[model samples]
Target: IHSDRGSHYRWPGWLDRINGSGLIRSMSRKGCSSDNAACEGFFGRVKNEMYYGRNWAGTSLEDFMCFLDRYIRWYNEKRIKISLGAMSPVKYREHLGVTT
Candidate 1:
């Protein structure tokens, strides 16, 4: 997981949990916003598009996970981006003959 160099992320408890899960911890250098800009931007878009001001009360953890998964899929597959010439990322890739 990537994050800023925060004390919470450096805590032994958090370190142990991340290690146990076999996920590598990645932290941006102090004062380096560029390193985190892409991730931060994606999360900002996610909150704006699906999270902010939404009523999520009574939603189970599993249900919320499913909803998030679906949203990500739709975002990647169907949502149009003017930056991508009015195409979804997947479509843009295909348009450029990118098989992967």
Candidate 2:
């Protein structure tokens, strides 16, 4: 997972786990936000399209939890995108004949 040097990601033991899994660790430089532009772009799109004008902002945690669950399902299964060749990511995998 890509992230800032925030509390959730700066754990000392995390290096061992990442190395054990044989996954290369990638990170931005200190105070260099452009090094992580992809993450920022996605976050910005989600916020603008799904969060900026929502009245649900004032909802209770339980309501927000329900909304999140439903939203994720819709995003993964029903959402289509031009970038994914006009298909949902799941559908794109299907086109490649990939099996879960």
Candidates in order: C-alpha RMSD to true structure: 1.3, 5.4
- Runs of candidate 1 exceeding 4 Å displacement: none
For residues 11-94, write the lDDT of model 1, one tens digit per residue: 999999999999998888888899899889988999998988889999999999998999999987889999999999889999
lDDT of each: 0.91, 0.78
TM-score for every candidate vs. truth? 0.90, 0.60
How far off is residue 97 in model 1, in Å?
1.1
TM-score of 2: 0.60
State the lDDT of candidate 2 residue by residue for 12-96, as single tens digits. 6987787788877666678899878877886686677677888885799998878777776777787999998999988999998
Global local distance difference test of model 2: 0.78
For residue 5, model 1's alpha carbon misses the true position, in angstroms, by 1.4
Clash count of each predicted structure: 0, 0
Candidate 2 Cα outliers beyond 4 Å, as residue runs:
5-27
Q: Which residue pairs in candidate 1 collide? A: none
Q: Could you tell me the C-alpha RMSD of candidate 1 in Å?
A: 1.3
